[model samples]
Target: MIQKDSAMKLPVLFLGHGSPMNAVRDTPYSRNWRRLGQALRQRYGGEIRAVLAVSAHWCTDGTAVTAMPKPRTIHDFGGFPQELFDVRYPAPGSPELAAEIRSLLGGHAVAADFGWGLDHGTWGVLCHVFPEADIPVVQLSLNVNLDAPAHFALARRLAPLREQGVLIVGSGDIVHNLRLMDRRAPDEAGSAYEWAESARSLVNGWLENGDTQALTDEAAYPPALHLAAPTPEHWWPLLYAAGAAGADEPLQIFNDDIVGKSLSMTSVVFGHDALFEAV
Candidate 1:
């Protein structure tokens, strides 16, 4: 007797979207996200049902799923121009997707207030990727208190959604030390760039080895990461993505560079082409 294989899962991603400015600019990181979206669309096409963004911008004590029919635009950042504030991504919310996520996680999911909208972390990258705002998107708030094990366990709960045509995106900077950034200086000409390069190399080695233990241990990290991430809120999203991958599969780098001194725009994909089969 022969058994049937389940539908192939789509690729999961954690994007190091650098700045709020990238939402409006034509920088390399911005361009890369855009191109990546195009590639993803081509790979999945109509079979791609919806998206759930686990963004750094939304932090809560527990798992919350945004179930609004139409999510509004939220300018979550401050000090940026009114033009930036005015920008909107009118992607519809996926209530079905939300319910599916709840079902997948069983008791771990919680209903979010309806009308929850996209924040900078969601829109900043989506503005480039799904520019037209075509796909229905739902935001999943991070459980900020969860340690490495808990967070990775939560990601495993989301595994079933991958086979259901949901594109899971974890959006945050890999090196997000806001205090160390000098936005006024050019990216290529800075001491922080040198530090960022060193940090990138270190991360690359860990990613190549699929070393989840090392990736999760900040204490053993290089000095650049210590300087880059004073706290792990923005960086932990990468672990969620990594956790969703096969234990031994190598990470694929989509974007890897530093900008604004302290921000490292290093996006990674978790699976191969076969895994990305038409939704």
Candidate 2:
């Protein structure tokens, strides 16, 4: 069983980072992220030792962790404005933390990755969250070979880091279907396709009720799963955040809106109620 230390335990975040533009644009989503960061600093002060990020964009045949001391800001997507590409989050990387993470998930044979740096899924949201980029950040890659249950099981091993002041963050959209996106649609709640809204609601219900099993089980998914996800990479990061959280921890939902007619910006936090107040 994963042990919990209430006093020192940090919260787990699953942020739905929709577009690379959000990193530079001053939208409500980015504003909330900035507020969330301020709230974290206000509450935890310098106790936030490091960040362990699991991003949808970083997927590998097997699990891996970024080990480079000075990781570069990666611009993985194309067609974005030059301003977005120019944006850099110069966060320091922590090899010690990466090694510790590999040690924690020793069963998975997690590799030390020096090549892959912080992709948009990690840096895009983090550039707003911890704007200063002073904290050491280490990214864990999503193993495409593993199923949702397997990913969750692997993430459970890292729960102990919470007590050590590690902020575990999973960056991905709850419902992401790029092909069906309607760019003209307003970015707000209830503006998505019916299937997308249904899918988001179903997942939110499971999260709110603490039904982690339903989330991982394919049979429990709605019929719109194909339209909602299209591919599992984006949805899989949520499992990591849910798995690392204490079973009984209170969950707070934020930025629960859908944009582009196919992307859901529903974010959740396990523990740290003050953050909800901040945003």
Candidate 3:
């Protein structure tokens, strides 16, 4: 079993995993992920016990945590290259962590799930972050029935895990509008449409200002919300990261770029300023 130090509180991360192709491609985002991983090991001295991933892909009727010892690498997407499909993240799963999470959110009826494995959202980012696949990973499912505030409250219950040396990660894009994505547009900042850029800027402002209420209030961005996040699945993961963060913890934003005109590759790290310094 991995040892944990109560004094060593791990940082929380919300990664905007743009596409499955990033798993195999060497883009700026992928390189940043690698640097971030190196910085994490350097800052924490390789003491991170496990990762609790809240991915956008795994949504269920109710909340659940992956408990199986060995989690399969699920492609979970199509139209990708055969090489991408073949790429496996062979990370182990922690049943103990799953049980701990279930205990943490006891009132939520969180199930011990064995049916689902590491989907693209989780593995795609981890493949670049912790490529060795040695750390145990447990994924928590997003309860579809929960509203924005309830999701944030549910995530707040997971705050204790950070003190136990568990790195909580929420993997999903802040602005993920698949329908509006311009395939021909170059994957670079300033290549996005006016609306997409505006939406991204608005969300970034909220994050920077520590305005959790504005971030959770769907009605706050009305017409922009319709364009930026048509659906809440991708956007909800951000709340998990934000909610898990302590009120006093410093928030750092990275990979602040918009790709394909509609996808914002903005990621956030809560606490551990030293890690960013190292990166």
Between candidates 1 and 3, the lDDT winner: 3
Residue 17 of model 1: what lDDT?
A: 71
Q: Estimate each model's TM-score.
A: 0.89, 0.95, 0.95
Off by over 4 Å in 3: 1-4, 186-188, 277-279
lDDT of each: 0.77, 0.88, 0.88
Evaluated at residue 196, the lDDT of candidate 2 is: 92
175-233 per-residue lDDT for model 3 (tens digits): 89988787777465567878887888888888777788887786666677668888999
lDDT string for model 1 (1-55, tens) is 0111348577888888776878997777777787788888887786567888888
Instruction: For candidate 1, list the clashing residue pairs, or say none.
Output: none
Provide the clashing-pair count of each candidate structure: 0, 0, 0
